[model samples]
Target: MDRRLFIKLLSQSALVSYGLLACPYLGWAKSAFDYALEGQELIQQKNFAEAIKALKESTRIDPNSDWSYGLLGRAHLGLGQKAEAVAAFREAVRLNPLDTYSRMMIEIVTQKPLPKLEKKKKPVSPLEQEAYSEEALMKSELKAEEGLEYQVKRVVIDAGHGGFDSGAVGKSGLKEKDVTLDLSLKLHEKLKADGKVKSFLTRTGDYYVPLSDRTATANQHQADLLISVHINANENKTPHGSETYFCSEKASSSEAEKVAALENSVIKFDEPYKKKAGYIDIEEILLKFEQQLYWNESGKFATTFQERFKKWLPLKSRGVHSANFYVLRMAKMPSILLETGFISNANDEEMLKKPAFREKIVNAIARGLA
Candidate 1:
């Protein structure tokens, strides 16, 4: 038999095994499957609106198909309908917990807007109420600090990509991994010299560290903060600026989501994180609430750090945004990721290649942390 025919037969057998062929709604299942395939093809062609329509039909025909829902989310995301994308992705994950792509999509979509509201004055859930209470406590602590004393005592600096991972490369031959590592080292030295707080580095030399391990290092040291250093890149090469980011369930903007996606693309190279047992139990629920509180604090700290760093940065300040970063997710302490400059731009690349420029960046970061 031909390879295509064999594959088709195998797929049909699998569908039958799943009882898709024997169901009372077999016609609907077949229709949904056809529409889903069409939608995927359309998405590949960048015809997102048409793809969305097909995917919507697929979902309506077979609401339980997690694959169709995940495709629908991608279609919505391509059209910049973040709220719709998040909802579709959330349903996909709920129907199939092992759908890592859908889970990542939910994180990316929710990093900005904190999920969409169904109606005006929606009733708050118990989890939301607890998160709000913790947020209030955090605010009170901040308000009580009338003095200019440092809020963070110990910090772990993480250089984004290294070793075989050269990260984004510039036309001028500058590598993101090299720049981040150098910048991180300089910042660590400056912070240590200040003597106000202790400092540590996730990577002191050129090498790769898994994203999860980076946060594990911070947690092990019981650091007060984690600052991840990275360089931005763009296909258009027009965007050039420094942006600080805090981890959030929803992205604050489409641009922030794109950045998160770019950074997260590296996850394919890392080992899969083994989830702890009893993930859906009470302990996990409480841990999620605590993480939310940490995220709230991280947002505040990111804003302050951006404000101070912008004053000294020679490049444009894109300001602070929030997104779900894998490197920041597991951290117990407040964490932020900084995109120092766009390596894709010629002007920014030239500046980034200079030792003096990196030193200036280090000084700005040190002052911001202070």
Candidate 2:
């Protein structure tokens, strides 16, 4: 079956597969407000395990509150317990069908094929919980390297596509290039304000900078890291999330390939423009396989970025993925591409338009890179 059909079947099976949290233990006295407030605070601090505990307590205290379950799902997502996340999100939707966040999150998680959750829901297995719990703990206790503090002498921010390249336009005409440019400008300004870092743009105006040129500019400057920003869209408006990608020789799955195809299409300019390309030699693609070191580092930064971003925006965290992206493949240093959000999704489009939300995203990225 096609992806849409697969997703539909997945969603239907998911709803029938998972049930509400079954509790045989005595309830706690924690209030819903207490759980939500404390959970939100812990999540802000990137303490997802503790946030899950707090949210769970809230749900135990008030089983009727869908907000608690939804928040619990967010915490589990941060911890990478996709199965538990799907369960919690499903419960949230069952409790309150009107909760869009819960519904969206459920669909996203289910699409990835999470295992059939236990009916008891009492921390499925300590081993699985421990793995994600450690991740949350490590993030909370983050420490800088001995002499490798978030040091950046030079930085390059690449706005995915521009002039003559409308990029991926949604049915509503929300162009990827426009959002990427505005977001990149915001990121540039934010990075520039950091006295320790000097920022440069591959292309500041609405002009197409060949993918090769974008990476070449960063490599020439000896950039500490390069960040390419773009927006994501899909055939179905239902899928919405923020996915970060790092370069790898491993081919992407069919879904990822579709996304890459849509994004790469932006750079297909006229022949005259193609002749001036810096990355015309296909030989360079093989060199990417040898740069596994940079790919590993880029993956680290991508993970950090997605974790920080999900705290502010309610976008689903699609995790750090690897793909043979041309923009990333040619880069000499660590490079990451951020698929901000689905511009095609009405809810996300509304959120993307807000200045406050944009600033929050920019600030999160800067902090993550720092």
Judged by TM-score, which candidate is best? 1
Candidate 1: residue 281 lDDT (0-100): 34
Cα lDDT of model 2 by residue, 184-293, tens digit: 89889887777667888888889887887888899877787898898888878887878888877774577777776776664455233334444322223223333776
lDDT score, candidate 1: 0.81
Q: What C-alpha lDDT, on a 0 to 100 scale, does residue 202 get in candidate 2?
A: 89
lDDT of 1 by residue, 1-370 (tens): 3332222222221222234433435544456666777899998766989999998997786677678888888877777677788888888877756566777667654544333433456466554454456557657876898334448899999999998889899998899999999999998888888898799999999999988889899988889999999999988889998999999989999889999998887788778856768432322333464698789888888988998999988889999999999999889889999999999999999999999999999999988898
Per-model TM-score on C-alpha atoms: 0.60, 0.55
Stretches of candidate 2 above 4 Å error? 1-153, 270-290
Which residue pairs clash within candidate 2?
A: none
Model 1: runs farther than 4 Å from truth?
1-150, 275-284
